[model samples]
Target: MPDGDRYPLAHRLYPYARSADQDRDAGGPAHHPVIVVGGGPVGLALALDLGLRGTPTLVLDDAEGIGEGSRALCFSKRTLEIADRLGCGAPMVEKGVKWQVGKVFHDTDLLYEFDLLPEAGHKAPAFVNLPQPDAERFLVERIRTAISDGAPIEIRGRNRVTALETSQPARLQVETPDGPYALTADYVVACDGARSPVRKMLDLDFEGRVFEDNFLIADVRMKAEFPTERWFWFAPHFKSGDSALLHKQPDDVWRIDFQLGWDIDRKAELSEDRVRARVDAMLGEGVDYDLVWTSIYTFQCRRMRKFRHGPVLFAGDAAHQVSPFGARGANSGIQDADNLGWKLDLVVRGAAPDSLLDTYAEEREAAADENILASTRSTDFITPKSKASRMFRDATLALAARHPFARAMVNSGRLSMPSIYDSYLSMPDALPDGPPATRPGAPCPDAPLGDGFLLEKLGSKFTLLAIGCAAPETGLAVVACEPTPELTARYLGAAPSALYLIRPDQHVAARWPMADAATVAAAHSHACGATT
Candidate 1:
């Protein structure tokens, strides 16, 4: 985090090279099975997933490298898990600052504190604060390794999508330093972000609310004694009467967010002198620090009504938008990629019906709704538009400081949690099962195994996990193991034994107390969207 050059990964990682993809436009569009339109985290994760599934993929990115700064620093556990499955989690975890505790304050007084990860046995931590640019770089590096190992993935830098034809085998007009080229794909995933050119070309728009408030971000590199915890303040005594947040990132960088109500002088607020004055007040007189990055942001809670349009699909910010308060933006976008990847792969391979892709749109649409609702509430509570609302919020904060019950009502930010889908693919739960945590629709919880973790065992395949039971010949690969205490507690608290049908994305599709070939076959068929 040098002040001179900022983040090391900020320099171009991908070099632009001229390709003959342009000549394909003369005859017709060069056809691919799947194409991703952005090189950001979501796009890269999705491409990596598809390639790992043996689906040939090509990523057309406008830029040669990731964006600068610690743009989005909070990567959720779910995001890390997804990255692990994509073979890039180790580097991401190594380069991140992990924290699970958070504190909320009203002025100088502590209201209440919360722990994000209360228990052990999970593989990924609650959150890892790594710069987004570093994350992208790591994912790209992993993709390079996978390509070397023969994973049918190609990323072309400086290839920008200028136009799109959303018909079946969606066509794209791409511009590069060399010239313009055209290509087509059976499906085009738009991870081009909130200002998505793909969405605009397809004439799509987001629907929801935009917050009027602005928050200034000052990412400063310093040697601070502050603990690795998220500290948020409301009506701080420090000069400004607005809310603020302090979070530590990797490489001794700190992210400070100062809420600057509705009206703000963008120029003055961003000035070196003004930013330094604010930092001085927060850190007290003379803390030597170098400003690495600074920017102002106003957030919105919005999503497209439909994520799928004919042959084109949307993920990440292209599909939905939310305020940064809850850490939902990039986290949910990566989850979107997670959900869409396997389904698209199965569809492309002709192993599942094209309608299976509909579940991606539906389930992730539901998740976007969940995130939007939470983010909207956090924004409203943080910046009350009405006098009455502000007074009520203040009173609630005051009460939360003393009473424990009121703590639930105080919303600084809800934080990101994986969506337990009411998915059409989800099977109904049987009574008498203990692990609602591993319910049919929920993301599988990682538990310790003999040598590795349960998630690592699940890998990126449809797996049958039979615990304390004999493996049945269900035509699906099975991992039959004795029930460990953790597995027994999570899978069969009251029951004797359990068998779980896991999806390629590691989400539980179905579970039963005992294994039978007929039953397992039926469940597997249903989960895979097999035609009867």
Candidate 2:
């Protein structure tokens, strides 16, 4: 067993000094332009995004620091790109275990191994495995740096919201260490997680299905030569009738999940002996491993019907939640922040109307639905509902070993990927013969540019990516990228020249082979919810 003292899991506390005292003396609630609740990955990310865009944000968290254990280990490429834009991607990638290969198994047999990224010329990989705590810490550091540089972002820890008033300008009654105080904001974002207090206070119902089976998640530190790849077993030898997942994290920590049946005694299952017995069975009896943390959770694939409730908005776990079969939880939440940040910034700056925020709900709700569907399918496949379902699942796995066609049907958690927004915000492609890879509503494909990737050249503002031709003069940021063979193949199929109007979030809003300034401006206006 590893020494617990040597590898201590310490919570870094952010000291809370009373800032509401002055407001109390002034006999009114302190006002902020934007107030974000729950300082988790999504909330922090949203604050960072708004801060970077020169929007003053105040973040309130009940907890002092990041959560314990290696939760949400798999960070997807799309999420990494979002983090990169937020100025914290490099550290996460550097600290994470980068891998793309995942192996699915039936009993002792290796059914199939799949590579998520077969061909890669992009800046970020298919996925990286960094513990949630580390990612949160990196974000916190980024926020602190921004705070130092006058970004107008303040994080007050141990400041919990006890009551919420969702008026035009939301009012929140916060309970701090000092005392209870009233606070108000022009806008309130609830990122308080699955058991969101904000959601509860508003009496919002999270409507969805909850799976019967429970999963035992245990983080174990051990010295082993296991390759940094995702290993999944369906009815494995160690756990004879259940599924098991083994994933590697930094610092030699491994996250193991055992799908315990519906009727398991939750407390007994999480006991040290029971947990150790399971780990020993999987890793062999003599393996030296230290139990870091263990928890039992039931899967619930659910979300609120509407992410936006009046002046208050919901992001991350507060808005939607899914079974952790796929890494959709944090990945989707980061995208939520990415989607909301720019839109909210526009509304804050009076560049767009408040109705622009509705577009955020529209686009993100579509994305959430996509994620929910994928996660639900994976959960159902993993934990079959009926005998027939189990039989079919087993047959599929059996055929997957030999039949190439069957491999495509296998669903061992279709890993998280960026969802293409197919809503009204995405303008239809004007060019009939444009490349589908750079189609409107799709994410902007990254390619090699001068010393950096093409995505690096695009600014946070609306950009016109002129490929293989001179960019037309426009008020928006424009970048003329020389079309190399790879670039041409990805962004400019048969066409020699194209103009892509990319959104602030790096999603292509419109594309045209040739367009005058009027057309480009109209597309931009349409993207910002203006009917031109």
Candidate 3:
């Protein structure tokens, strides 16, 4: 009963689905060249990528094994692309449920339904909802294989990195059941989570506002079946205080979250019976379910003011924690790895300088701040204080459901739109002063190519697009990819005036009617870490 549309898919689904650690490494001096503090998805993904790049990494986790808990199930297309690059996407694609349409309902009343796969693209919409543990397992297996293939990766379970100190490089003092041992690395990445000891030990400032409201989350197997077609979101479930969310997981499991207002007895309120009763109240009579897991937690939208400190860097929840409204936590964390992976590869290969690491803070910070604003706005909409805000929230969704453009806006907020980066290092060629064109620092959109491959295939590397005009013989070596026909028609009001340069991450690096020495130099300088 692993959710809907079950298929006998690939076996490698959720790479980190390692069996619980039954064997305890009798407290030994297990040291690697580079040690990853957290063994969560981010840390694991980092280890996998590092291994692929011929770097030996040590992953240490306090947990006995991978997590089975259903937290952060949604994976964006960008995330899938990263997984595919790691050779782990096939298994994930086979096992996970592809959600094409996301329906929003207000107390059994259908408000709006957005088809995530808007047009010709991957069959799996813009995202897939796979159990977090499954994903972790898939990755863990991959790491093990890489290790067998001479990857210097050692996964030490039940080992916690208690303290961190930097000398010439950086050092981690991990506490095991036996004793504390010292390990050093060229760099240390703190993906340990929100309550990261690394961030705390370093005394790095996590700055942001904390909302007073607490949310009660429960993963349960429902006795009463509901349509898997929609995501039920209620502002105030049957009252002005109680709120609930209904989402589907991989198995025949539903994850329900209730915003149980500002006041409640923390100790007594989270009891089993209390949770069961609350679920019954929301769905109304005859609703029965077996609670698989239950937890109460409060969150604040905050990010480490600085992602990098000396040789230490932060990823995932350790770097930022956004309200779960947009499913930003795990997705953004994975992207952080994506951002860092290639850059680190380049730096290690001497293709890029250490300064390239600075872009991690710059690009990711922008994304984090955007997530904060979006999550805060969503929370404000649902947990409205003033009458006007409540009314606006109601009217906005109501109106948008009827209007196409407005409908897009509503979906954008809910679907967690791909983040854009506006770094000080962005080039002028990418963002020409002329009317709005697909520019750098913007999430690259797909356009049609002749061979049925989307423009993105060419975008895996830095590209220069020529839409209408003849291709210019600029001395810079870049992928001169084609533009989307729709874009050419809409933006140019006709065939596009050729030459648009794109980045390796698929962002538009430079757009010109024709490529020239000035634009080529500008694009190269920007992409090669010269602008920074």
Please give, for residues 229-348, the per-residue lDDT of candidate 1 as tens digits: 999998887855389999998888899999988898998898999888888998998889999999988899999999998889999999999999989999999999999999999999
Clashing pairs in 1: none
Clashes of each: 0, 0, 31
- Those runs of model 1 whose alpha carbons end farther than 4 Å from true positions after fitting are 1-3
For model 3 the local lDDT of residue 269 reads 62
Global local distance difference test of model 2: 0.88
The regions of model 2 sitting more than 4 angstroms off are 1-10, 20-22
Ranked candidates (lDDT, high to low): 1, 2, 3
Each model's RMSD to truth, in Å? Answer: 1.4, 1.6, 5.5
TM-score, prediction 3: 0.81
Give the per-residue lDDT digits (tens) of candidate 3, residues 1-532.
Answer: 1322322322323333232232335653334456678888899898888778777777878775665457777787777766766767767877776666767756546667767666663423577777777788888888878888887677777678888887646767766666666666777888899899888898886899787788887777765566554474655445423456767766677777788767778766678778777777776777665677677777778998889887788999999998878778898898888777766666656777778788878899888988888888777776766899767767776776577665544532365666766675465642243335455555455545565434435434455555545555664344444445555542333334546665555555555556576667666566657743
Candidate 1 achieves a global lDDT of: 0.89
Compose the digit string of candidate 2's lDDT tens values, residues 234-337.
89899723999999988888989999999978888888888888998999978998888788888788989999988899999999999898899999999999
TM-score of 2: 0.97
